[model samples]
Target: MTITFRRMTPDDASAVTAFLTANRFPFHVNPAPCESSANKRVAEGHFWSKESQGYWVQHGGKDIGLAVLEDLEDDNPVFDLRLAESHRGRGLGVDVVRALCRLAFTELPQIVRFEGQTREDNIAMRKTFLRAGFVKEAHYRQAWPTADGTRLASVAYAILRSDWENNTVTPLEFDDLLLDA
Candidate 1:
């Protein structure tokens, strides 16, 4: 299965709405998004904006998911990746992360690092981040709000441009600084 990323435009609003409403993203802030809400989000430039850009995650020429790269004007850009229900456990996330890194680092020269955050319970995504060479940088407690009025720890992972270029994983020295209580 050949994975590819296609840039999304305003004309693709309907497609984006359909994709969002058709799939259930349990890990996302809004899991089962309503059609009207999806339409509203699309209309409000949630996908395509000055600070954000969207892309279609295609496999074998078919649209399988969506990847929205946010904070484009910033040095560290983050992405939100969602795959179709049928394509979730098929090991497509690593490829999606790679594609996002390629798109950000290769296309945007100003980006110093590429980051992504997922709920603490999202084990698959955490593993995907590790596999994609992203080091765990932060874990904000109760940062991810779910649809069920509950919150989960938001685990952030990032990869520097130097690491990406050298094809290496720069391990974080979390234990370097020790403070006396």
Candidate 2:
């Protein structure tokens, strides 16, 4: 599968609003977003700003999903990816992730790492991250709030620029420190 990223602008508000409201994002904090709220977010520059930039994930000239890269001014940038309900679970996660990595590292040279977080129960995304050469770096217990009023563990993953360039996974030394009682 070939994936492409098209930078989104303010003029794409209607398209973005439709995309957000048309699909049900089961894993996101707001699974079912209303059209008005979606439009509000776009109007507030949440998608396109100095610190954040959104992209339309395209495959075969069709928009399949949305990817928003945040904290662009920082060395470690993070992203939010949402695939349309119709496009999910057909082996597209890995390709989208790899494409995002390529775009970030190649287009934005100053970023040292590209990061993403997902609910611990989101096994598909976790696997996709691992397969895409991202290392699991952090796990915040009960940090991801769901629309149903429950919180789940937020698992964070990241890929270093050097690691991505070398096609390697750098394992985290989680046991490096021990607390003395």
Candidate 3:
């Protein structure tokens, strides 16, 4: 299935709202979001603001998800992806991530890395990150807040431009404790 990305606009508010209302993202901060608020957010440019940009993940001429690109001005941009329920479990996350990498690395030359984070329990997203050539970088304890007023460990992943271009996984050095020798 051919997957593509289109920059989100105000005109896409209805579709965005529908996508959000249709899916129950367990890992998201607000899982059961209302369509009206989703529309308000879209209209207010919450995702597609000066510091960030959003996109519609299209598959077979239909919008299957939304990818919100954050911290665009930074050297490393992060993305929050939410796929529709009907499109989930069909192995589409990896393709969306790969497309994101291409957009970040090729379109934005200044970006050296593209980052993403998911709850520790989100196995599907973790696997998708690895499949898309992203390396595990960090894990923050109780960093992700959920809809039920609880927190979960957030696992960070990133794909360097060099890694994306070269198609390799360059491991990050995390063992930096120089203890008493």
* C-alpha lDDT (0 to 100) for residue 38 of candidate 1: 95
Off by over 4 Å in 3: none
List the candidates ranked by lDDT, beginning with the highest.
2, 1, 3
Query: lDDT tens digits, residues 43-124, model 2?
Result: 8888999999999999989999999999998989999999999899899999999999999999899999999999999999
Clashing pairs in 2: none
User: Can you give the lDDT of residue 13 in candidate 1?
Assistant: 92
Higher lDDT: candidate 1 or 3?
1
Q: What is the per-residue lDDT of model 3 for residues 11-70, given as tens digits with 9 covering 90 to 100?
A: 777877887887888888888789887878778786677778888888999888888989
* Clashes per model (N, Cα, C within 3 A): 0, 0, 0
| TM-score of each predicted structure versus truth | 0.96, 0.97, 0.93
Q: Where does model 2 exceed 4 Å of error? A: none
Better of 2 and 3 by lDDT: 2
Residue 172 in candidate 3, Cα distance off native in Å: 0.9
Backbone-clash count (model 2)? 0
Expressed as tens digits, the lDDT of each residue in 37-114 for candidate 1 is 999989988789989999999998998899999998899999999999998898888988888898889889999999
